[model samples]
Target: MFDVGSGVSANWLRVVIALVCGGILVDIARHGVGPLPFGFAVTLAVACVFIPASPAPLLLICVAAAALTATVDSPFAPGVLVLLPLVHLLHLSCAIAALLPRRARIALAALRGPLRRAAVTQAVVWLMVLVGALVPVGRTPMILELAGLLSIAGIAVVVIVLDRAR
Candidate 1:
């Protein structure tokens, strides 16, 4: 149950987030590596707007978009790189919006810590991706495999540590 006083504000915030995310998704679709890659992103954004409490659909959409970006054989355009962090933010915003109760007085202050943590985590992840992109590496299959494995391991370790800390 929400602290009734803030329900309207909270719902408005949620709608705004959904709209911004949807807009970003549309932009991504417009400039995406391929038309199919971001098609789900826009669709999911609309779904999220209608059903803000269900965060999983938007999460899956984000994952799919990221996967498509990774697998697409496109040039490393600077614009795409800039769009990456915004996409991450949209995902974070959607998650936060979903958690908000429809009839609660959500203290904006209460969100500060979680938002800051999420931002920090996103920044770290983006930095890693940027570094990987900037560093020119041989596209040998063996090296690519090794790098993928290491990345997975690193992500697992980070997840475990974060869980423990929580």
Candidate 2:
């Protein structure tokens, strides 16, 4: 195992990056031009912190905390909104960064160990469930489907490239 001290520091960095990026994007979206829903900020934050680490239950706790604060009209919501896009961007970036030829970093995470693999599976399932429950099916446009398909294809291609690299 890696050194405990180093690991904590690394996790702290991840959390800090997520908070800063998430806050900036959410703020800009809310005040600069196109305003996103408050929940988007929460989603972005969770995605930023958890996406790279297998999305544990603790991440869900953080999400829940954010949601609760929003429902109660927490003052931090405004600042948090600015960073929303950054958080999401970071999450996507992490997934993409691991792209080595064909296999995506996510695929590598899946192949790493049982715990890591299970976390990915669970995170995917949880994401689907959360999206289905929170976002109305009718709200998403046809473009969403296209985006989803493209994402899957991209990941698959990455995996293929990784396999070839090996």
lDDT of each: 0.65, 0.48
Could you give candidate 1's per-residue lDDT for residues 45-152 as a string of tens digits? Answer: 677666766764557456455754675555356445555655666666666667766755567777789789878987897788778777666655888679889999
Error of 1 at 114 (Å): 1.4
- Candidate 2 lDDT over 1-166, as tens digits, reads 2223312223444555465545544454444332344455456555655554445223533543454445535333544433333444454434433232222123333334744654675568557655755665466788877998999999999999999999
lDDT of 2 at 51: 58
| RMSD to the hidden true structure, all candidates | 6.8, 14.7
Off by more than 4 A, model 1: 1-8, 32-40, 55-75, 139-166
TM-score, cand. 2 vs. native: 0.26
lDDT of 1: 0.65
TM-scores of all predicted structures: 0.59, 0.26
Task: State in Å the error of residue 17, model 1.
Answer: 2.2
| Number of the top-ranking candidate, with lDDT as the measure | 1
Best by TM-score: 1
